[model samples]
Target: MTYILQLVTAGLAVGSVYALIAIGIVLIYKCSGVVNFAQGAFVMMGAYLTFAASRLGLPPVLAVTLALVLMAGIGVLAERVVLRPMLKAPVVAVMMVTLGMLIMIRASCLAVWGPDPLAFPRIFPDGALELFGVFITYNYLTAGVLSILLSLGFLGFYRFTAVGLMQRCAADNPRAALAIGIHTSNQVSLAWAMSAGLAGVGGTLLATLNGLSLGLADIGLIAFPVIVLGGLTSLGGALVAGLLLGLLQSFTDGLLSPMIEDLLRAHTRIYSVGALQQVVPYALLVAVLLLRPQGIFGRKGSERL
Candidate 1:
């Protein structure tokens, strides 16, 4: 039970990070109708910016704040400069542009920061908490708590706030919302800003847990399964799905991998499973795609011809 609890705690922590990124993806899809594949780049941007600030002797909190602010600016600039111009382009073309942006951002990071991973400065205070015979590090506790809180707060803002209502209105029908006096374009831009800012915080949290690295952008791939599982347009679904995926990963690492590897080695001559936890998310993605196209939280809707 203690072991299970430990895994669950770890899973929720990782899942919270996934949820943050997934929410950002859903928000962009909702508001702009353009999937920002470069969302992960914003994650990297935040971590790198934080790392840079730390190098300059800034405190962790201020560094993280600065990074998020810069990430928001980058989001706004991407909307105004890259997406807005080609707003009328084919969906595939726009998606390709986002992919191009991702590649460009990565290349730029490599050029500026080089390829080695940096030892991230500690953000959370050093310590551990023991509960019910499970030991939890302060980093994990803080990251998990912060991630879940931020996700919940964003959901609250989306559900109860005026700006949230406006974002929803624009997402429902941009043209109609514009006709009704809402600034649909501004909503789209704001979506980008909020999404990027969320991703920035997520990135900082992840870096504190796993160290800062260019490879942090690759976590976006993990998020693909999360949003797909949650429903591309469902923010709430993303949160749930992120937690689900995180649990699957944690269990796979803790139990399934060892069991399968041992069985294979004893009976079938296979030596290893080669990181089974990493495979779990994609396997779940495939299952979700085949079984529930609308996703667990998505609803079927009608459209007028």
Candidate 2:
């Protein structure tokens, strides 16, 4: 029981960061109808930029803030320069462009930061909290709490703000939004900006946990399964799905892997069932795609034929 609690706690902490990044992806998809494949690049760039800022002697908080600002600017630039021109292009073309952005950003980071994982700058105070026999590190506690708060805060902003209403209008029907005097294009830009900012913060928090590396960009792969499971258009669904996936992966790593290994060793030549936890998300994705294509909170589209 104690071990289970420990795994749960650890899962929720990592899951909160996943929720943050996944929310950003959902935000862009909702507002612009563009699936951003460069999201992982934004995540990687955010961590690298924060590292750079810290190296220039900025305080940790300030470094994260600076990274967020730069990331938001980059988002807007990408929207205007890359996506806006392709607005009338085929969806496949736009997706390919985003893939190109991802490749370009990764190569740029390789050239500038090189191909080495840097030690992440310390953000949280080093310590651990013991409660109910479940040990939690300060890093995990702080990151989890902060990510949840930020996720809830962003949801609140989207639900209650005027700009958020405009964003929703733009997302629902750009022509209608334009007819109503909303600047749909500006709303799309804002979505990208906000999405990038969120990803940047998520990346910074993730770095504090996993160290800085180019591999951080691959988080987008995990996030894709999350968004698909949660409903691509539903931010709240993303939050819930991210946390659920987190907990599931944790349990698989902690419990199922050992159980499976033992079973396999007992009956067969296999002494291992490697990285089952990593496969869980994709399996879940396939299940959701087959069983609940509309997702938990997503509305099914209507054909107007």
Candidate 3:
């Protein structure tokens, strides 16, 4: 039971990071109707930025903040430079452009930061807290708490704020919103900026948890299963799905893998089943799509789209 609790805690921490990145993907999809494949690249870039800032003598908090700000600017620039021209293009074209953007960003990061993985500075105090006989690290606790807080704050913003309402309006119907005097283009730009900024924070959190590396961007791929399971248009769905996937992955890694391995050893010739946890989310994603295409919190009408 204690081991289970420990695994759960660890899963929640990693899942929270996925949820953050997933939220960014959902935000861009909701507002612009274009899937931003460059999200992983943004994560990679943000980690590099944080690493750069740390090298320049800034503390972790300041470095993360600076990285977020710069990422937001980069988001805006990406929208202006890469997306704006393709705004009138087909959805497939826009998506491909984003794929191109991802490649460009990855190459740029490699050129500037090089191909070596660097150790990220510790953001939280180095220690673990014991609760009910389970040891939980401050890094995990901080990341999980902060991710939840930020997600809730974003939810509140979407629920009550004027800017968020404008964003929603733009997302719901860009032409109608423009006809009604809202600046649709500006709203789209804001969405990209916010989405990129959130992705940056997620990246920083991940780097702090795991060491900094180009591979951190692969979290974006993990996020796809989260968003698909949660529904692409639903923020709340993203949160719940992220946490669920995280916990599930953790549990599988900690418990199920060993159990399955032992069972296989006793009964079959198979020696190992490697990284079963990584496969879980994708499997869940496929099941969700086939059985409940609308997702847990997704609106019924959205299934048509």
lDDT of each: 0.90, 0.91, 0.88
Span of 10 residues, lowest total lDDT, candidate 2: 296-305
Q: What is candidate 3's lDDT per residue for 239-275, written digit by digit as tens?
A: 8899999999998988899999999999999978999
lDDT of 1 by residue, 177-236 (tens): 989899988999999999999999999999999998999998888998998888888999
* Candidate 2 lDDT by residue in tens digits, 200-246: 99989999999999999999889988988788899999899889999
Error of 3 at 44 (Å): 1.4
In candidate 3, the residue pairs with backbone N, CA or C atoms under 3 Å apart (3 or more residues apart, or in different chains) clash, namely none
TM-score of each: 0.97, 0.97, 0.96
In Å, residue 210's CA in model 2 sits off its true spot by 0.9
Off by over 4 Å in 3: 301-305
Model 2 score (lDDT) = 0.91
Stretches of candidate 1 off by over 4 Å are 301-305
**How much does each candidate deviate from the true structure in C-alpha RMSD?**
2.1, 2.0, 1.5
